[model samples]
Target: MSEYYGTTVEDIFKTQNKRFRAEGSEGVDAVFAYDVQGEGGGRWKLTIKDGACATEKLDSDDFGEYSVKITVDAETFVGVTIGKIDGTEAFTAGKLKVDGQIPLMMELPKLFTKYAPPGKEVTAADILATSESRFQPENAEGLDITVGYNLAGDGGGQWTAVIKDGTCKLEEGLRDNLTVCNIVKAKDFVDLMLGKLDPIVAFGAGRLRLVGDMEIAQRLPKIFSKFKSNASEPVEELIMLKKIISVDMKYSTGPTMGKFLNGLKEKKILANVCPKCGRKQLPPRECCAVCRCDVDEFVEVGPEGIVTYCDIIYYASPDPLTGETRETPYGALFVLLDGCKDREALWHLLKKEDLVDVKRGDRVRPVWVENPTGSVYDIIYFEKVR
Candidate 1:
């Protein structure tokens, strides 16, 4: 029984279906073929049946036969499996490539259990302690930048990576007149260093703060080596946290909303005109959010409208009520009706051929259901108006 730390694609595939089962929990179905380039790199196919995954080495590497073909180096494959580099980040960085079934490939995380290699807590200090080794001399060959890091907490401290002409030196203390600063928590910084946290997501979410040149901040990840955690601490007495927040809620919809619902039964879209601002609101509300006055007058808006924005959802959980997974990449449309005033928009699904080539300001007409009950689904979905 060998340990899991010596990460190899072949070694990992051999031990599956025993300790853990991959239940394609995201309702994805595909056969994934891996095409690696490097020493001992070879072709392998992973069949994801419903939610379960099983792997086999392919004798002939014909990528066109598989549902998806992923291309990467041998190290990246090992790195991805061991959590040193995230697949999405790798793809974004152009270190990894996927030939087909991209959405299915995105569901790869469900096919493998998170295996934490056995090791002691490699602190953030231990990682940054050898920061010089992580820096790339080539990237910063003639670059001069001072980056200050402040990781606050019990196990946190300030450190700086000062680079000059391609050489980066790590100091445990603060450095003055820095080019940029990144302030993060100790645990989060360690996670980010180990590829457990995506820098892109972190920066997007404001977890990783940048004070100065963002371009210099962007260059740091590429120049540095990825930190690998030796062992992941197991959860002992880990409470399965849950809380049920039940709210018994109902909306009266007032006279304005009530009239709007009535209009819906007759297959009409209505809006309320505000007295103060003269603003029109669709799916009429009692009072306008913009104007503090009552919206007394009602008028019909769009039987045909323009799409303001649309999202083509490729993957998401199955519908709770229907227990049905939709054939994905469906368009969720936000439409501004023909007669609507200002920026108020209604939500609807864009169906049929309308799903293709949908863009902003594309004209759409509601497809009403036959003899509809006053449900919102009465207009089942909207379609492109030719």
Candidate 2:
């Protein structure tokens, strides 16, 4: 038997979990190696302390506290391993194993930079270049469009542009033939492409400049909004058709829900039940929609529940906190807790396989957190009774 004692992947995960729970630190020191079949492979030496990780290309002298060395076939490394890097299958398949403190291993997801598809940046650049190229035509379709100003870098200047017969062109004296149909700073344009800004504010606040017909400038917002919606479409065909563009729109950050999330870290389940219908709400709310009454009474729920339904998410959302999509699918379920006889249930993410086998009427309990916060996110989720 391979006796992985104090320095094993499982131990690393466990220790990291304890450290995170006890001190809220996701720090560790580790060495990891990916053997890329016959071509060439390298190792990564990582040092993590005080919740920060510094990694470097490894050498023979590079030995660390925790280590993972994976050797697989060359074809497997190129096809399977790389694919697993894009998804969470490597961890699930045991192809990617960790050796060291288990708790720190668990924190790896938070520490590591996720891999992103390479083409997005190129697509954004292409969109800008293509638009600029198309707008630099002179005397097209007899449109008397004129560029009133030619200010480069910040796009701050007045320009007089005209439109004729459904065609627009920039006037002479303007360096570029394109009149500003919509004005946006270069930075704001990048932010808009990354889903970090709103179009209305970008234009209204003068962060984006507008020229030519006011009607065209006004219609740009609607057009850009539709363009954004089309860009977000998941269909491969639609994605190829929709060119990526940049804009300047700032997104306001909502209040941090960290404390509420930390409550879940403590393993406490907090929920609100409807007084009239007796429906249990997982994310405890102040008002019950069905009963239209204030749910003043808070109650403790379970660490267990049945997996009602779930969907695998491979795509990333605009929400920044979600980070990168994990390779393993996170299971979400609507669990009916024990002692809540009113058929009321709370929904949350499930962390264990026992939850997968859970059926109706299965006994469940809440894994309560040590410290209680008066928030619904205090309870991570319920686990099934043994």
Residue 333 miss distance in model 2 (angstroms): 5.5
Estimate, for each residue in 1-386, the C-alpha lDDT of model 2 and write its tens digit: 11121122222322332333213334454544444334333444444566654545555533544465554433333343224343245545655443433234445445543222222232333334333234423324444444343333543333334455644443334445554444455456656655678766776787767666665455433222222322323334422253445566875322223322444666645566688877766556667878888776666665455544444432223334433344343455666654444446666655556534656555555655566564464555556667
Checking candidate 1 for backbone clashes, the offending pairs are: 23-51, 24-51, 119-231, 140-166, 141-165
Residue 298 alpha-carbon offset, candidate 1, angstroms: 1.3
Among the numbered candidates, top TM-score falls to: 1
lDDT of 1 by residue, 1-386 (tens): 22324556666556554424555445556788888778657788877676566677877777546788889878787788787888778876888887766656545554666554434667788988877987878777778889898988767899999888778888887788889888988888888887789988987898878888889887877778776665655556545554555677796766777888778899998888888887778777878787677778988888999999898875545665444667666889889998774577888898957777889989999999888666688898999978
lDDT of each: 0.77, 0.47
Runs of candidate 2 with Cα error greater than 4 angstroms are 1-30, 38-66, 71-278, 290-334, 339-344, 347-361, 369-383
Report the error of model 1 at residue 236, Å: 5.3
